[model samples]
Target: MLRNAASLSVTVTALVLSAACSDDGREASASASQPTGVSTAPATDATGGTTDAAPTSSGTATSEPTTATSATATASTDDPVAPKFDIGGKDLGASTTGEGDGCKKVDFLFVIDNSASMEDNQAALIASFPGFIDAIKTTLSEVTDYHIMVVDSDADGRCEQPCVMDNDYQEFCSPKNFHACNANLTECDTTRGAGVIHPVGLYSSNKKCQVFGGNRYMLPEDPDLLATFACVAQVGTAGHPSERPMNGMQAAVSEALNAPDGCNAGFLRDDAILVITILTDDPHYEDEGTPAEWKASVVAAKNGDETAVVIAGLIPKPDLGCAGNGMTQGAHWQEFVDSWGDHGISGSICEPDYAPFFQQAVAVIDETCDNFNPPG
Candidate 1:
């Protein structure tokens, strides 16, 4: 059973702290074509905060219980001013990472919360992932480079950490239409148009990929990220959260910026404008517990290269408690809107279908970034 969840408020408090951290990796762009974001605010005291950590389980790997200490950005950083948005105002006081315009390439990493409650959600997510890539594919018809990192809270720390890579050290798509999968991976069924993936998802069990035969599992069919599955079930434990999200966010944006070998990954160009799309059911709190966490995630994502963040909150839009409990699970997304730095999109999953929720968000983001190709 869910460990005696922290008392409702206590649980919310714990979840909140994990979202806020003092790690700032900020940078500024030399041109208006680049984007920048920062992660430095103040260290948070995760003490007494609730643990959304998934419980330990006998899985493919040893679960590495993360500790949420008062951490700092301790990395080469950037500091850019925020960007424009449709809804919220920009937090003039908030920090950012980089600056620039558009990007030609994009290395997207989708980090999902796969706790028990997310089981069905995860399936839906997996089913829908290829769609996002497909739409992106339409815009990048000439480019075929991409990568994915799917994180599930429950991972065997020793064998496969929660944030382990599916295609680490390798690129995806093809050189010719390479945006689907690298030339090496052909098992993928790209017939429906999702396109094959290169460098494919890697499983911790096969580090060198000798056993599974890199080509055997690296294909791109219907958004298969099973490589990161075993550990996706180890969340909701009793300790603390993690700090890698901030780091991962940076990596994704970096890929979007410089792309491969100083060249854009294939979309537009390494220096092409960057746009970020975030979908979460929870809040990015700003309290001592969560503000830092959310900021860190944002910083990693922006890295200032002319990035635009579009947040889609799974929770329906409410008139009140935006700064408190209701939003704690879905933190600073509102801050982004308020700052006019990021557009905040919301919907009620209470309805039978979440498509409208997703569509509305996609629409808002499309309008803001001026880049969107709805599934035809």
Candidate 2:
């Protein structure tokens, strides 16, 4: 449950009395007693109105009033207006210590959109990656074991046109030109072609790689973590123009479950927290299945313990408005996040900097870990 610090306001009243006196030190009585006055202005500083000098009256004081004004005033310290740890105007729900035997492990799957328009977003994410890791480490003392993997948002099942080896990461084709003639060249697929970089192939297909000593886990302590992430994350613009990130994620997880000695076989642990973060600017294709189905796929992969999963997203937010350039309100992405309750957090993908997003995500993860109910 969420805890709040309450500020208490107490009102204290002090009685003051004054009278006019003669030169002989005898009281010069007034016709009648003046009414008592009270200052109700709130103190604005920590000194509690003590620092400023008090005003003096010309009349000499004889004795204080015997009749004291007795009144008690109490102001609620609880902020009825705002919460301290709010994100994008939404108050985070009552936190729960996630189900686990301590926060020993975490499995992070980043489904990055590697389309034509995601270059800047990708750069921001990469630059902020270290901060995210630092936050996890800072909170947990040390994360016992964590696996990080990347998959691009392209699961269209159709090969992109004229696929070839243009980039250095292209293991799909060789250096030699497959299509060439006296002018009018016809581009053709090599033996591996489209499937080589496909999400399914990287995780579930027979062509799945044994990059980590015949397994798919990439440790946080990996010597070349950034380069490795960048390699897989840069899926390039050669993929089909229409993206299916939900389908891609589903395929990746499904492959991890079914493939023989699959890349993701040992990554998902029984006690580990699973964080699946999607970075996309477009909406999920309707043909890729609804958000419910995708969520179910994740739950199933995590052994039906919904407490073991956190699905965060960095996509376009509504009010900030992704107005320019053929962008929707990211309603479909928001729909996916809404289904997860406190298990999900969504931030704007249009921000030029992703540091705040990373920090908040890390903080959320830390809070989730703190709420986890460890086994006996």
Candidate 3:
């Protein structure tokens, strides 16, 4: 099921500080409540398999700024050519706008949990992704530049083991032994926080997925976006049992990983609107820091413009009876999503189809792009 926080009773008052950047002159607020009258229904998947459908919910909340200060732009006396905005104490010149006031570039980050219980979730994400991107391309027609990257929850990339032994007794790790293993022993796997182009664990294809450039992430010019994305997004189910999505997200956009020589170099852009989508059934109890601190890390990465980031996720919502089997409620994840107000979207991981949630997220992403004032 899909629920937007705006439908709830929470009121968020945003103070738009700049007139030049506030074309819509609107503020966004949202909060979530447990849905009532819940009932279980069998939902069929693309493969004809049946799964439980989430409870019916209202439409998604409209995207808007929360209590946080919106981005502002001021005329620069030093340079007469363009205006400058102070982002995280650094003055960045404004980029030339398109036909209307909207961001020309967008960066999409997908954080996927690769634990033992994520096989179905990963397949669902891979199956639903083409339509999601197609919707974005159609709805946000002006956005021609894009950077899409995927990262797994574990930073170590080691596989869980009791290694599988061959006829000669040589041991190795594979998807067959993913559930049978108890300790992390296989070291040759995809690195966490780095954009995945070559996944090597559990159910991974274990082949290098090529993009337009030799970069780790996918660009708009990639020859086969669907195929490449599917290859890397299938991170498999051999990651550390204790998932750390927040840490992976923070590290993915951190300066260390975005550096010229880093594994995820050139994935993040200062002038682009950032949209992060996390897919996981784990509660992430092992992840460090509070929701506020995690939000701060992302905002800081985006030059401190909270409005430039959009957080969306398919997580366990136990309160609504939408959590997967053996999955606890993701309290921290829920709080993190709520902290973004309208910019945040949370969906139940138990849903039979993730397409609807992703489709709803497009509206929020479009609004964010419309209001984004890119740094020059």
Best candidate per lDDT, number?
3
Give the C-alpha miss distance for residue 38 in model 1, angstroms.
27
lDDT value, residue 61 of candidate 1:
10
lDDT of 3 by residue, 194-264 (tens): 88765655566555677668887898888788899998898766566678988899888988889988888
Among the numbered candidates, top TM-score falls to 3
> Tens digit of lDDT per residue, candidate 2, span 90-116?
322324454434566788888776544
- State each candidate's clash count: 114, 5, 1
Per-model TM against the reference: 0.38, 0.59, 0.68
Error of 2 at 349 (Å): 0.9
**Tens digits of per-residue lDDT for model 1 on 221-245?**
3143443332221121110122122
Q: List ranges where model 2 is wrong by over 4 Å.
A: 1-100, 156-214, 255-260, 284-287, 323-328, 373-376
- Could you tell me the TM-score of candidate 3? 0.68
Clash list (residue pairs), candidate 3: 93-376
